[model samples]
Target: MGTTTEAENKPAESARRQKTRERLMDAAFEVFSEVGIHAATVEMITERADFTRGAFYSNFDTKEELFLALAERGYNERLELLRASVANIDVIMPTLLEQNPGSLTATELGPIVASFLEQQGDNRLWFLFQSELRLLAMRDPEVGKLFLQQKHAADQEFGNIIAAAFTAVGITPAIESVELAIVLMNTYEASLQEAIMAGGEKVQERAHELFMQRMLGLISQLAS
Candidate 1:
């Protein structure tokens, strides 16, 4: 009877634990969003979660570990959204172009790019991660090399998608095509960064339209 009772309670207990973990994660994200990765700490996180200090330590080994987990989660979520969006690129690309028609009006790409900044989200976290990893590699030169190799491979896969989208003509990308694609990506990032810093609401408009036109032109070129 005792064993059976314990077994029955296990699932319930497991669910409660999951709930607490999620609460901590939510609180941590809120804190991280408010300031940044470096500024957030265990006390800030636990206070936000309404949990005790012990709870924080119980769940996460250290602040760095927690930060990495949070960064990883954000990265994974963004990747999922991007992958899903990419899957529907055939549909999403054109619909946005059709919808917005005013001066510097935001199209679908605007919202998509905004989703990436994630409001309070740390864009710098990923950049810092890569930089730190590279720095560590310079010293240790062991695990870091393999880790970077894997990451670079994954990055290349995403790059191929951009290249293919810009030159999906089944034809090899010409020097002009590659140059245009690189330029378009750089332009989009620059404009988005400016939009973010400027507090301007709809900065993706011009770059987006310009890029789309460029893509269409490439497509036409491939067809011709």
Candidate 2:
């Protein structure tokens, strides 16, 4: 009876622990998003999650650790979204086909990718979070090393998605898949940064569409 009770309690305990961790991470994401990693405090995260400082410490040793965890979570979430969206090629195909009839050129497909990229969430929040991480990585050696490792993993996953997307449409990627992925990603980021810096809400509203157009032109040149 004692053994059975202990066994039954173990799974329940584990689930509770997982729930707490997720709650903490979710709160941290909001706090970090609003105030940034440097400005965010454990207390703020705990208060947002309605947990205690002890709870935060139980799951994460340091603010930096939590920040890294948040970054990893973002990367994983994005990969999941990409895989799910890729699985349903129809989601992308309609737009690509409508853009320019006949066969799906790389140019047409590029905009479809831009559309999926926008589906992740609020562009301003994402851009701010990413910019913060990049700046922090550049300033700190240890963080920089960790960031590079994380970026490489993310790049590989994105490259796989790009390869799958091209293969699905029956067109081989014109360049090395990873290189092409890098180019597309860089273009998207740079365009977003420029839009955020220069324009108002109107720019934010149409930023994704503008990016798609720019990417279509660039990808067409690159792929051809």
Top candidate when judged by TM-score against the true structure: 2
TM-score of 2: 0.84
- The sequence of per-residue lDDT tens digits that candidate 1 reaches over residues 1-224 is 34568779999989987888779887876676566656778889999999999988878888656655654565466556546655655554455435542221222233333332233234433433444444545565664555465455445444554444433322343444435334444554554444445544454554344445444434333222
lDDT of 2 by residue, 153-220 (tens): 77777777777776765567778877877887887887788877786886556677668768867876
Candidate 1 residues lying further than 4 Å off, grouped into runs, are 1-4, 94-154, 167-190, 200-224
In candidate 2, which residue pairs clash? none
The numbered model that scores best in lDDT is 2
Provide the lowest-lDDT 10-residue window in model 1. Answer: 101-110
Candidate 2: residue 48 lDDT (0-100):
99
- RMSD of every prediction: 7.3, 3.0
